[model samples]
Target: MDPLHYRAFTTPSGGGNPAGVVLDASGMTDARMQEIAADLGYSETAFLDPGDGGHFRIRYFSPLAEVDFCGHATVASAVALADRDGAEGHYVFHANVGPIPVEVHSTERGYAATLRSVVPSVAPLDALAELLRVLGWERGDLAPDLPVGVAFAGLSHPVLWAASRARLADLAYDFAAMKDLMIAQGWGTVSLLHRASPDLIHARNAFAVGGVVEDPATGAAAAALGGFLRAHGLLPADGRFTVMQGEDMGQPCRIEVDASGDGGVRVSGTAAPIPVA
Candidate 1:
């Protein structure tokens, strides 16, 4: 299998979250795919099984295990497909989460892919105290406006809105403790965020559950964030915003979000191949 490394959500090669893309994983077993992902050491790697026409079956695997969905890897895979297939207009991906529709366009920035996630829903806050204690975060650290809640786009992520940007930047935490809580709660990641403006936000994600300290940029979390904002009436009915993540890790990623009045959210970003290893 030819594995390609690509970074999603940034124009520059050094920015965005790096993902390993296996363009063809037909003969590979699940164990082999898992081993490849673990060895690659990215938060997630996408395996694409080419199907008839432009449709494909995609699977996501983390170093520790396979996940239902992954946004950055999906973006990376779409760009990889475009690079090989001469920029197919749009492709349908059958993922573990559901049917994901991705459109690729050739821009000055290269292949920019936009994916419309499955209809998102906010999960109720049932165990906020347990989650807070596990992270060693005080209740005062949370933003009153944003609040704490669970949101799911493709995967479930607990949204913890920080009261200040400083708190969001200070992200050192007990990895083992967080991993325990996340695994027990079946959370993919903790979506830490600080609102800069009504339409702009700074975000960080702790992905201990995925066996990664943090994710540089997370598309699934971004979709969940948009859903959280709309579900809680934090953003306007027809709102659009941008999320800046991965800056603290020095690989800044920009994620554009659009929330329709009816309830769907769209996330868009640029993806490029990383330098060959």
Candidate 2:
């Protein structure tokens, strides 16, 4: 099988989060896929099995384990599919999390995928102290503008809003220490963010739980961030915004976030193929 490597959320191929995409993973065992993912060593790899009609069965594997959903990989997979099949129309994906629908469109920039997340919910303050302790972040580092909470779009992520943009940029922590804490908490990723404006934000995702120090651009976390913003009334009705991530790492990904008054959030970005070894 030919596996495609892709960078999602950025127009340039070199930017965004890199993912391995196997468009046709027929007869591949879970163990085999897991091994491949571990060897590839991206934050996540996607295996897609085209089913009847336009439906597909998708699986996401991290280096250390399997995850319910992965946004960047999904975007990469969709773009890979469009590259072979042409860009246009909606593709349905059956993931461990649930059914996810992705719409593909051709734009002046390139082929972009807009993914609608599974039913999302925000957690009430339940494990704030433990979560903060894991990231080595003091409670005082939190911004009063945004609330601290757990948001789930597909996978679970603890959203921590930094008090300032500088705080978000200066990301340094004990990887193993944070990994142990994330394993205990069962978190998929940690969303560390700084609000640049009411509509624009900068984000960083620590993925030590996935055996990766960080993710360049995380679609799942972006979706969770949108939900968190809407739930806390941080977003205005009919608000549209962009999130700049991976810049600190020099990857520089851009994710477009749109919030509807009905409470559903849509995240859009481009996914370009990365060559697989």
Candidate 3:
């Protein structure tokens, strides 16, 4: 199957996280999928097979291994489908985690997709000291207000809020150690963040566990962060916020997260087609 290239959380001209989307992967084997993902060299690639009643069976694979779920790739796949089909409807995706609903709409800029995550959760992180050491961060560097925890939307991420934006910007970390720790701990990413305002936040997700140094924009992590904020009473019961990521990488991704209901945060962003060779 020929893969459709799409960049999720992007601007008009294309600065976002690129992903490979195989919309009709009916008979593809797991080994082939892994090979394709590795060959593409994106953070992740999505393989989709049409399921009953407009639902799709989706699988996400990184260069190294298959992940339970991936938000940016999901967004990219949905938007690509919408471009091929039509926008203004919801697409059901059956993932390794659970059933996820992605709503697509034709916005002024382009096709935008919003995915409602599986029941989000937050819990205390166990090895905080070792995790911090891997990141070259100390306890003092953490934002005392936002407690360190493991947050899960579909995949688990260690949510660490930095005390200062500069600290977040300076994101030099030991990739090998972090990858080892993440594999052992079953963490998908280490989401380092800095809140600039009540409604705006800056984020950097280290994704060494997935054989990638970093993710430009992570919708799964964004949803998990929203859930963590609401669970800890850091934000209002109904809250909407923007996360700006990839600024340091010069790609510039924007993700909008809305935690309006009791469970499952909604993550939204626009996607653009990447020029394929």
**Candidate 3 off by > 4 Å:** none
All candidates in order of TM-score, best leading: 3, 1, 2
- Leading candidate by TM-score: 3
Please name the candidate that would achieve the greatest lDDT relative to the true structure: 3
Residue by residue across 1-277, what tens digits does model 2's lDDT show? 8567888998554587899989899899999999999988889999998898779999999999998899999888888888888757689999998888998999876799998888678897477787677667788889985678889888889888899887888888888888887878778888899888887889899999899889999999888788888777888556677888998998999998876654446889987766545
TM-score for each predicted model, relative to the true structure: 0.96, 0.94, 0.97
Clashing pairs in 3: none
* Each model's lDDT: 0.87, 0.85, 0.91
lDDT of 3 by residue, 111-221 (tens): 999999999998889989999999999899999877889999998999899999999989888999999999999998889999888789999999998898999999889
Clash total of candidate 1: 0
Which scores greater on TM-score, model 1 or model 3?
3
| Tens-place lDDT digits, model 1, residues 192-240 | 8899998889999999988999999999999888888888888754588
Q: Cα lDDT for residue 207, model 1?
A: 94
